[model samples]
Target: MTKVDILAFGVHPDDVELGCSGTIIASVQQGKKVAIVDLTQGELGTRGTVETRYKEAADAARIMGVDWRENLKMEDGFFQINEANIRKVITAIRKYQPEIILCNALEDRHPDHGRSSQLVEEAAFMSGLRKIETSLDGVAQDAWRPKYVFHYIQDRYLKPDFVFDISAHMQQKIAAVQAYTTQFYTTQTADDEPQTYISTPDFLETVKARALMLGKRIGVRYAEGYLTKKMVGVTDFNSFVQETT
Candidate 1:
């Protein structure tokens, strides 16, 4: 079993990069083991092919310093939250055995993001049931559940339960996002290439501004916000991130 401290789930290859690469980079720098799971290959994306997404995802994973990444090959924009899909998610959760799970926002601009979020959330809970049998490579796997499931705010702006400071790794996060040159605007972008919502330079600028805005709320230079249904508890105030007054 490849145990990890955190497992991040994204519906598309670049979803993780756009949403929480800064946090992922911060965690890696803190010596925490992290892995990324993309629920789909992003074949339906207008700007890139499945093969291109695979390459971009690998590049981003390397930039974030995640231990490893795997794509579930779920149908892009059409995967259902049923027994098969849930089992696949459960198997991954069991295999990684992470204490924390980071997933897409509960609601986002892309329907796939919200759908995948619900699927992952449900799977995380069901993974704890001993009777819910799951296996990988024909071997029976043990039921495993994460301590927390936090949704990274992506396209839609909702109130966050907490914000993670990633000031030190903000540049790294941008690099990760730029890895998908075909999906996002870059210096090398062709004039003939079709521009979509995320493929524009302005969108990238907004990404940076969003991080800065979130950081401002916490008196930091850069940060990522997250939402969670469960209450967060702390043993002491000493563990909290003190804001600079």
Candidate 2:
């Protein structure tokens, strides 16, 4: 079985890239194994076809240097948070047994983001229950829960519990986001598709502006913000203290 240090979950193909690609790139650079699991193919998106989105997602994964990426093929707009969906997520959680799990924002402009966040949060908790049986490829799987679950900030601004400095990875993060050519703006694109909120140049600028605002909070050039339901503990206090000299 392939094990990873971090497992990121998104409701749509580009959600992870939009929210936390910088963080993903930074983690990968630090020699951490990371994988991304998209809950849906983003078939309902106005900008691209399911096939196109899949290709874009794969390209983005490569740009971010993730170890692996998979799609659960869940219903785009109507996937329910039931036992069936929970079990599916649990199976992946056990299969990889990641130490940290990153998920969609708890609330966002997109309804799927919030719903998927709740689903993943509940599933992560239930994954630790030994009585909940799950198997993969005819082999009984063991229950495994991540040590930490973090929600990445997406469209709407929410106070972050913590932020990660990703200044060095900002360029790579932009590359990953640009990989979704059909969904984002590019001078090369022919005017064949209707312009959506995300396909405009302003959208990309807004993304950068948000990153700048978050980075300013920590005196960095760029960063990604995250929220946690539980209190996070650190082994060293001096590690967070800014140097005056």
- Each model's backbone clash number: 0, 0
Q: Please list the C-alpha lDDT of all candidates, in the order they appear.
A: 0.93, 0.92
Among the numbered candidates, top lDDT falls to 1
TM-score of 1: 0.98
Error of 1 at 158 (Å): 0.7
| Candidate 1 C-alpha RMSD relative to the actual structure | 0.9
| Deviation in Å, model 1, residue 80 alpha carbon | 0.8
With candidate 1 superimposed using the best TM-score fit, by how many Å does residue 235's alpha carbon deviate from the native? 1.0
Q: Per-residue lDDT for 1-245 in model 1, tens only?
A: 89999999999999999998999999999999999999999998988789989999999999999978999999998999999999999999999999999999999889998999999999999999999998889989999989999999998888899999999999999999999989998896656767899899899999999999999998888889999999999889887677797
Query: Candidate 1, residue 11: CA error in Å?
Result: 0.4
Residue pairs whose backbone atoms clash in candidate 1: none
lDDT of 2: 0.92
